[model samples]
Target: DQTSKTSYDLVVIGARWTGAVGEYWRSKTTYEVIKTIQPPVLVAIGEREQLKRFLVCTGGKEFIEQAVQFTGRLAAAVNASVTLLHVMAEPPAVYADMVRLEENVDQLLESKSELGTNLRRQKRELERLRVSADVRLRHGIVIDQVFEEAREGDYDLIVTGTSQARGLLRHYIMGDLTRSILNRAIVPVLVARAGPAKPGRTLWKAIKGLVRTR
Candidate 1:
């Protein structure tokens, strides 16, 4: 048997899913592939030739550029409706923190001068591309909220992109979020990483100190 295999430069599957969104991909997963084939998780809902609705998940600035450009280009190409979703998670705590977090989330979502400015900028960029889009803000568990919205609406694909340049803290925390969404999402999750897949092991440590130390 040919034991050696190369990474998938781009793998687009059909709409038909045997089980969960990533189950098919997961079942076929290999340690070799998983290590090197890490890319942004862009989840496609159903098997269709053209996308009708696309969901762009944004919050962190690291991935926003890739997220916006990719979403805009794809939406304009297919003339799909874009829903820019930013899921704000309540701070982890009890009564006081919960209430405060809720209030803060409310403020950001309600105030035109807050998150609204960012959303407007996003809208303007898409408008320049001639791809009309609407902004949506939701509060709760980030992954849960995203899934709930995906189910309620007719989103054809879910676009989530971010990069943290291999940090210790980020690896344990934010890494889980991305992995969880990819594993659990009923829709397609696109996690965009900018680079080519390599032939060696995936997690090759290159950084000597904390990124913030500099």
Candidate 2:
């Protein structure tokens, strides 16, 4: 009943794998905690430093906007650079050539597609907060593509979002995907949520107020 009863502004956990035998159970427990939590989670794996470059992952899913909004506010705080990344899964061989998954952000924006439109909306949202972000596209398995991009881009932080469905349904939906990213990511991963869980509270309003006052 914790997921149904409690909420938080943020849930932060440290990550340090010793490569021991017991690390398996430790990882499993961490994943469970992440899936059940109702707010954003930050899995910190290394030393804390100034976050200069942020890689925000967007799949046009539930919390993409929230993730971008939060990132924009945080970036504004330190005057950091932001990059919006959208990853496409490898296509079937039959349609591989037609998909042209290699198309970059600029090329995609020129076309009329849902993904392009979503990216534009997210970019505009960042612009509203006075943060200009670079848009990038990749093709492969979601997690793999993200890892590759993180290494190639040398980003300081990785921001991703998932559905906030609770209990059993949540486990089947995005638990693995979210957990996997946190487990393997070399940089800190900010798992953004739709909003606060309880009524009479709005995370966006609080963030906006902070940004304005800054």
Candidate 3:
């Protein structure tokens, strides 16, 4: 008899814009975004886990460098691995244009030419950081694909970012992807809010400061 054994310390689902943003913050700030998350309940699991792996699910639209950097840091801190997953949704024939846009890997790579360059640089950094990492491209619903991977990979935890709500009504409504993953995920989940902070401003400010100094 053979036992199927796969394990990871952590797995982050939903590699959307928010996830990328979270990665950026984590890389730059000394403050622990996951630890300092509002409500405190969200990151409890991540804090408790010793060995962690981050599995970031992307739609192929997001910049891979951000995810790589974030995971690289977490992995180095926890001595874990970072895995990237890209999921594709199928559409009807009438949506050929949309399908072409989504399915054309070459075009997608070309479109984010700068991001691709950044990813290469980050990959080198990740290697120096000694974090094991790999990227996978798959086809299916984002939520379903993540769940399936979680089970198969035997991930101990999943982390994702949420949207800040404006009011009580908005708070009650979970974004579709978050809602689905939360409802179906078998493992513990860490939800971080991707608040409306302008992450780029810090870089811009630094640039301006350099100009003044010069």
Best by lDDT: 2
* TM-score, per-candidate, Cα-based: 0.61, 0.73, 0.49
| Candidate 3 residue runs with Cα over 4 Å from true position | 1-52, 60-68, 91-125, 163-174, 192-214
Report the CA-based lDDT of candidate 3 relative to the real structure: 0.51
What digit string (tens of lDDT, one per residue) describes model 2 on residues 1-214?
5556776667777777566643322356556666666667777765548788989988754346777888888888879889988778778889866567446567676656767776888888888888868898887888888889999988889987766554455431345666677767767888776532233458998899899998
TM-score of 2: 0.73
Clashes of 3: 2
| Steric overlap count per candidate | 15, 0, 2
Reference-based lDDT, each prediction: 0.59, 0.73, 0.51
Question: Could you tell which candidate, 1 or 2, scores higher by TM-score?
Answer: 2
Evaluation by lDDT, superior candidate among 2 and 3: 2
Tell me the lDDT of model 1 at 104: 62
lDDT of 3 by residue, 58-175 (tens): 4332333444455566668878776655666766779879666645544544455543443345546678889876554455778878888776776765645544445443231235
Using TM-score, rank the candidates from best to worst: 2, 1, 3
Please list the residue runs of candidate 2 whose C-alpha ends up more than 4 Å from where it truly belongs after superposition: 1-8, 17-29, 92-97, 166-173, 195-214
- The lowest-lDDT stretch of 10 consecutive residues in candidate 1 is 194-203
Q: Which ten residues in a row have the lowest lDDT in candidate 3?
A: 23-32
